[model samples]
Target: MQVSAGQAKLGADQITEAERGLLDFVTIEDGLGPQSSRRHEPDERTDQVRGRLDAVLIASRVAPLTRHIGLVPTVVATHTEPFHISKAIATLDYVSAGRAGLRVRISARPDEAAHFGRRTIRRTDAPDGGQPITELFDEAADYVEVVRRLWDSWEDDAEIRDAATGRFIDRDKLHYIDFEGRFFSVKGPSITPRPPQGQPLVTALAHQTVPYRLVARQADIGYVTPHDADQARAIVAEIRAEQQAAGRAGEPLHVFGDLVVLLDDSEAAARARLDRLDTLAGEPYNSDTRVFTGTAEQLADLLEELATGGLTGFRLRPAVTGHDLPRVTGDLVPELQRRRRFRTAYDATTLRGLLGLTRPANRYATTAA
Candidate 1:
C-alpha cells in the first residue's frame, strides 16, 4: 500500500496526509502535455508555468513539508538535456536528504516537442528513412545510458580537504566517462558531487523491447503492465536476460508490476464507484491490464498473487487520486502491515530503504589492480 501521487488538482494536502500516515512515498507527476498533435486540452494555468511544476517543483514543495516520505519526480528524457537533468536530480537528492528518485520517461507524441522549440521527433520515421519508431526508442535508450554514466561520473570520495595544503578535491579521483553515442556525447565528471545516496534510484516503464532493454541496463527499477501473471513472469525473464547481456546482472534491479486500482468496502460498491468515475472521466476506464476493483483485503490478496511473479512490488495508479489515494493509505496499508507484507513504520529514512533497495555502489568503485 505504498502510495505515489501524480500531477493533478488532487491537492498537496492529500500527499501530506498520506505522508503523515506513514505510507511509503509520494511521487508527483511533473511531465505534462496534450493528448495528440492536433488537440489541446483546456488548461486554466499558464502552459509555461504549469509545465515547470512537473516533478521537480512538485518534489521540491513536498520535500520540506514532510520529513520521511520519499519524493520521486518524473523527469521526461525525450526533449531534455542530460547535463541539465544530472544537476537537477543531484540538487533534489540534496534537498530531500537522499529521499529523491527520478522516474525516467520517454515521450511519444510530437506536441511535447514543440514546447521546446524543436522539430517534432517522430519515432516511426527514421533519420535513414528505413528504420521505424522502434529504432528511435533504441536511440533514446542510449540517451538514458549517457545520463546514468554522467550521474556516476564523480566517485564518492572524489572530494578532499587538506587545510594546510589548500586542496579541496582529488583530481585523480575524478574520472571522465568520455561517453560517445549515436544521439549525443558526454565527457568527464559531473559538476556536482556524487549524490547523497551515491546513486539515487532511476525507474522507467516499459511495454516493448527497446524500453525493456533500457530498463535492464540503465534503470534501478523497471515498471511493467501485464494483464496476467504469466505475462509478468515473461517480462521479468526478458529483463533479467537483458541485464545479464548488458553485464549488469550483479545490480539489484527491481521489476515492479503496475496496476490501476479502484478499491472500496465491497465488490458491488467498488464497481458502482468505478462506473461513476469512468462516466466522469468521459470514457470507460480501461487499462492494458484489467483494472482491479474490490475491497482493500481483496486488493492485497491480488497484490500477493501478482508478487509471485518475482516482482519487487506494485505501483498502483488510483482511478481517482483524491479519493482512492486516501483509501490506499488508510485501508490497504494497514492490511499489508497486519500480514507483515509492508513496514508498519519506515524502517529506514531513504527512498532506497523504503523500497528495500540497497544503495548502489558507486560505478567507479573497483578493486585495485
Candidate 2:
C-alpha cells in the first residue's frame, strides 16, 4: 500500500510504474490527519507521515493511465457517510473498468471524531465514555452493510439509453435499500448505477477478534499482521471460525499477511540499509507488522512458509517506498514467479477477475425475480 500526496500527476506516475511490474494490485492509503505512532493523537514528530492525499481520488486519477492492476483505496468508515462512499467507489469501479476496490477503516480516536462535530467519540478513560470496541466494530459492519446494499440496489441493465423510445432507465429494475442499523440508516438506489463489477471488492485489515468478525462478514480480503507462521495459522483459524459463525463459511475470504520489508541483494546488506535508516531516524522502526530485512529469496521463503499456515497471500509494505517498492516489483515478484507462486503475465483485466471471484448476482434482482 502507498500513499502519495501533493499531486495527482505524481501519484499517477508512481502507480503507472508499479503497474509495469505486473503486480496484482496497489493500495492507496488515506488518512484524515497526519497518522502518528500514537493511535489517537496527531503528533509533532517529523519522521512520521505528516500528510496524505485522498486514496479514492488518487486511484481515479491513475485509472486511465494504467491497466490490469487493481486500485484499492482506503476509506475511513467511522466518520464518512456510507451512501456517499458507495457511490464514490462504484464510480471508481467504472472509471477503472472494474479494477477497483476499497479498504474499510475505522477512526476511533477523539481527535479524529472531532473532525466531524456531529458526534463525539468518548474515550474509555472519560467519565461518560464513548465507543467501546464492539460498538466501533459494529458500526463499521453496519457501514459496510449500507455500502453493499446500495451497490446491489440497482439491477444490472437498469439503464436503457434508448433513442428510439423515450426511456432512460427501467424504473422497476431499481429497488430501495431501506437499511436501518444501530449506527445509521440508508434509503437507496444509489445515484450511480450498478458498478462494472457487481459489488466492487471490499477489503479490511484486522488485528483482533472484533475486526476478524468484520472481515468474515463483509470483506473479500482481510489484511492481517502476524509475525510468524504459527501466529498466521492461529489468526487464520480464528477468522475461519468467525466466518462460519457468521454463516458465511461457504463464501470466499482471503486472509493476507502484512509485512514490512527492507530487501537488498543479501541479508547483511538489507540489515545495513535498515540500520542506516533507523540511525537517520534516531530510533528503531517498529510497527504491528514485523520488519523483515533480507533478500528477495528470503522474503519468498517466508511467504511460502506463511502460506502453509492458511494465509492465501501477503501484502508487503516497503520500508522506504522509493527504495523498496522497486525491489518488490523488480526482485520479489520474479522470485515468486520462478517458484510458480506469482503470475508471469497479466491474466485478468478486472481486479475481481484476477482474484478469481465471479461477478455476484444482484440481491435486489434475485429478490424481485
TM-score of every model versus the real structure: 0.87, 0.94
The superposed Cα distance between candidate 2 and the true structure at residue 191, in angstroms, equals: 0.5
Worst 10 residues of 1 by lDDT: 34-43
Candidate 1: TM-score? 0.87
- Candidate 2 is scored at a TM of 0.94
* Best of the candidates, TM-score: 2
lDDT by residue (1-369, candidate 1, tens digit) is 344433334346876876755766655665557332123233453322343345677777767777787777778777787788887888888888988888887765555666776545555564754335565566667766776677678778878888999998888778788888877788857788888887778887788788898899788878888877778888899999999999998878888888888888998999999888777656686665558889999988888877777777777777777778888888988888899887777678788887777777767766579
As for candidate 1, its clashing pairs are 30-54, 30-55, 123-133, 124-133
lDDT of the candidates, in the order given: 0.74, 0.83
- The parts of candidate 1 lying over 4 Å away from their true place are 1-11, 35-52, 117-119, 123-131, 161-166, 365-369
Compare the candidates by lDDT and give the number of the best one: 2
